[model samples]
Target: MTLPDFRRRKAGNQRISFVTCYDCAFARLVAQTDLDCILVGDSVAMVVHGHPSTLAADLPMMLFHTESVARGAGGKFIVGDMPFLEHRKGQSEAVSAAQALLRAGAQAIKLEGAAGNLEIIQSLVEGGVPVMGHVGLTPQFIHAFGGFKVQGREDAAAERILADAKALEASGVFSIVLEGIPATLGKRITDALSIPTIGIGAGPDCDGQVLVLHDLLGFTEKPPKFARAFGEVASASVTALRAYDEAVKTNTFPTEKESYA
Candidate 1:
């Protein structure tokens, strides 16, 4: 289904859950669940490629992961993130990047920022490509924002955040992802918008929630403070890998009964 349909569903008070996936395996697992969307986030820079931040993720890397997720999504809606610098070249560049992602099987595209992005978003929307708006703690602007700090903490900042949220909605975005904002501000934005607000560190009052898949699985050695581990996959993965190594060293694998005749 189109993202607009999903937005309508969300507006009817249905909570949507989005999960991040960087590869086909995780995308397959996500498809088995009831997740409404899968975001091929540039956070893959940190979680998969061992980068210190998302700034290190380039478009080719993002497209690689986006295609992998798309292959395993099994028809689920996929949103591919426009990596840093992909859209900074202007509206035409943004459309080209977004079009490449759509051809790569993404149902939608997400870009950071609010002010400089309205034209890009408008262009994409006009071309029948759904756009998911992301603001508050936009990792792409880590350099400008001066590191991964909490946004909307001050009065002026909070007002700007609110204004940005409204402006994004006015630009025909299907939904907005509010990240790392104060709970009160998140709640107010949620209350004000017709489109659903998907929160990452925003709060429980948002219309829906999203988390990086690795963060939820505890695969990251140090996830963001707001991330809650729903499973000990990290520990389990280590144990399983260790066991496999031990079995191989001991010649315990490929047993007689386990081998093909």
Candidate 2:
């Protein structure tokens, strides 16, 4: 689907589905699913590169994954995430960073946060970069938020988040991702925006929902509270590996193929 198609889905009350993918194999796999968007999320720092935080990964790593995902994304819409501090320097830096991602094959870039990020988003949008704004428990703000806690729990905070969403929309974001916020506020923000809201840990009321592929596929041992495992891929991988080890140990793997000689 195209970026603009998300707005049409919002208009129709149809929910969008987004998932984070980092590599070509998974991107190709997701292309076969009914999902509407594949985000090459910066969560790759934690999921693929064994980093404890998203900040550990840089723009080059994110761009590498974006290229990998785009190689196999087929016709699926791809949103590349700007890594921690990738665009934090200033609007000029943000525009350059975003352009780098777009040049690497991202259809759009998901910029995290308000305040400083809002101005960057406006600058990038004006520069012809399609942006997806992210707010509410943004990982880049984890240290600032004192951990991955839910945001907008209080009236003032909720108002602030809602205001951020409004300002982002006015700045020309095609869509916004509401992450780690209360369900009531999630719905409130979703209802407040004309553009589609794709939620992760936000709530069921968003125009779309997203999850990390590793978390959703049961590849990660301990996923976040909001993530649900739809498959036991890790266990399946272990089982397959054990079987392969046993076959090789018993010298049975090449027995059938030996007949070709």
Candidate 3:
């Protein structure tokens, strides 16, 4: 979907579909699907490289994945994550990082949280970088949060998140990802924002919903409670491989017609 489609979809009351994929192979598959966008998320550190968390994702790592996804994503709108502190360093530093991400093929950049980064976000938007804001259970603040827990649960915290969402919109983000917040709060923010709200564990009231490709495909052994696995890819893959292994062991593969005549 084009950038304008985000708002148009929201206006039309249509729900957007977004999924995160880290590499070209899956990106090619995602491109062929009806999914609206692809995010080269920092979750790559955990999903692809076996890191314990997104904290391991760095500029170079995100760049590499963004480049790979862009190469095979066709016309899919790609949003790359600004790994960890990439945006907190300073305005110039954030712009430089965003420029690199854009050059590496992200049409937009998704940064976690709105507090303490409004100025930088405004500068990026004014400079013409499409920024996607993320708040409420930002994974980058996992330590501060003590774990991957729901955010904006209390009245005070909910008000803060609502305020942050407003601030982010004022800073010129095209859309915002409302994550790990209560469904009511998600609807509240969605109603409050002029731009689209993409939900991840934030509930169905959002303008759109996003899921990790692995989680949706059942590759994740233990996905978040909000994630729904629509396909049994991991188990099917293992079953297929086992069949191949048995065929090879029994010399039942590459026989007769399968071999060069």
Candidate 4:
């Protein structure tokens, strides 16, 4: 879907379904499904590459995956995730990074934060780049928060997130992602924004929901609490491999029909 269609979903009252994938294979596979959006999320730092956190992901890595996913998307809208410093340092850097991501085939770029990132978001949008803003328990800010903790539990913090979302909207973000917040707060932000509010751990009140493809398929080693596995692909794969190994060891795998010669 295009950004306009994605934005329209909020007023249309149509719930969206977004899934995150980092490689060309999954992107192509998901594009064939009923998903409304595909995100080349920075969470790949952990899910794909085995990094401890998103902080380990960089521009080159994100670019490589962005291009790969784009190749497989078949013209579907793909949001390339901006790694920490790509937008944090300054507007010029953010623009440069965004340009790279666009060239790499991302229809839009998503950055974490609102208050500190308003300038970057504004500059990008003004320069003809569409952006998606992320707020509430930003992973890039994990150091500051000490971990991936839920946010907006208290009145003051909830107000801060609301303010952040407003600032981001004013900065020209077409949509926003609300992560790790309460359902009430998620609904509050969704109601306040004209654009769509996509939730991860923020709950069912959002305009849409997104989840990592790995977690959704039960391929992740330790899935997060918010993730629900629809299929146990990992365990099934293990079992199949074990059966193959046993077949080979027992010399029962190659029957007359299985033999080419």
Candidate 5:
């Protein structure tokens, strides 16, 4: 899907399907499907590189993965994430960082939080960049929130998050990601914003839903409650690997039909 599709989907009440993909192999697989879009999320630091948090995702890392994803993404729209603090530096730096990602092949970029970045968002949009805003449990603010906990649980916090969503909408974000908040708040934000809300841990009432590819495929041993494993790929992969090991041990892998003259 393209940038305008995000708004059209929300207006038509059609649920958008977004998934995070890091590399070309997975991007190729996702491209073969009808998924709405692919996000080369900062979560790659944690999911693919084994970092404890997304803060470890630097601009270089994001560029590398975004380029890889773009190569195999086919016609899929790709949104590259602005790494931690990349946008906080300054207008010039932020735009440069965004330029690099776009040049690397992202159709758009997603950034976390709107509190201190509204002007930056506006600047990027004014400069003709498509941006997706993310609020609620912004993983980039993990330390500020004291961990990957639910946000907007209390009345005041909920109000703040709702405001953030609206401000982002005003700032021209085509869509926003609502993460780790109560179901009621998720619905509240979804209703408040004209742009689509892509929830992850935020609940099913959103205009759309997004989950990390690994979590959705059961590759994560301890995925969060909101992530439902639609497939047991981890276990299935292990079983296949074990069979291969056995075949190799028995010298049966290159039997007559599997060998060349």
Candidate 6:
């Protein structure tokens, strides 16, 4: 289904759930769930490659993950993220990166910015590519903001956050992801925007919520504070691996009865 249709459905008070994935295995698992969307977020820098921050993720890396997730998503909407320098170069570069994502099987592309990116969003929309807007605690700007801190906590910054939400909506984005903001401010933005607001620690008042898949599965050694661990897959995986190791060391695996004649 198109993103506009998803937005319309969400406008009726439907709560959309989004999860980030970086590979086919996770995508396959997500496709079986009731998730409304799967974001191929650049968080792969942290979750997959052990990078210090998302800024280290490049276009090729994003494209690689986007392709894998798209191939395994089945029917879930795949939202590919444009990495740090891709969009800042100019409108043409943004369009090219977005188009490449669509070609790689993404149903839409998400970028982080407001005023500086309206033209790129408009151009992508006009060209028939669905776009999701991301604001608040944009990791790509960690240097400018001086680390991964909560945004919209102060009065002036909150106002700018509201303005950025409105600007993204006006630019024709189907939805906006509000990350790391106060609950009251998130509610206000959700109420003000025509498009749906998907929050990740932004607050409960948002139209929907999203979390990294690894975080949700308890695979990350240090997940964000706002993330609630839904399952302990990491511990379970470790236990299973340890069992296999013991079996191999004890010659308990590949018993004679298990061998083919």
lDDT of 2 by residue, 133-215 (tens): 99899998778988888999999999999999999999999999999999999999998999999999998899999999999
Off by over 4 Å in 2: 256-260
- TM-score, each model? 0.96, 0.96, 0.97, 0.95, 0.98, 0.97
Q: Candidate 3, residues 1-261: lDDT per residue as tens digits? A: 888989999999999999999999999999888898999999999998998889999999999999999999998999999999988887888999999999999999999998898999999999999999998999999999999999999999999999999999999999999999999999999999999999999989999999999999999998999999999999999999999999999999978988886
lDDT for every model? 0.89, 0.90, 0.95, 0.91, 0.94, 0.89
For residues 1-261, write the lDDT of model 1, one tens digit per residue: 466676686668888888988999989998888788899999999888989889888888888999999999988889999998788897778888988998888989998889888987888898999999998999988989899999999999999999999999999998899999999999999999999898999989898889999889988778787799999998998999999999999999969999998
* Model 6: lDDT to the true structure: 0.89
- Model 6: colliding residue pairs: none
lDDT of 4 by residue, 1-261 (tens): 887897778788999988998999888898788888889999999898998889988999999999999989888789999998778777678888999999999999999998778877888998989999999989999999999899999999999999999999999999999999999999999999898999999989999999999999999887888889999988999999999999999999988899897
lDDT computed for candidate 2: 0.90
True-structure Cα RMSD, model 3: 1.0
Off by over 4 Å in 5: none
Best by lDDT: 3
Off by over 4 Å in 1: none
lDDT of 5 by residue, 1-261 (tens): 878888899999999999999999999999889898999999999999999999999999999999999999997988899999999999999999999999999999999999899999999999999999999999999889999999998999999999999999999999999999999999999988889999999988999999999999999999999999999999999999999999999998979998898
TM-score of 3: 0.97
lDDT of 6 by residue, 167-195 (tens): 99899899999999999999999999888
lDDT of 1 at 162: 95
Alpha-carbon error at 146 in model 3, in Å?
Answer: 0.3
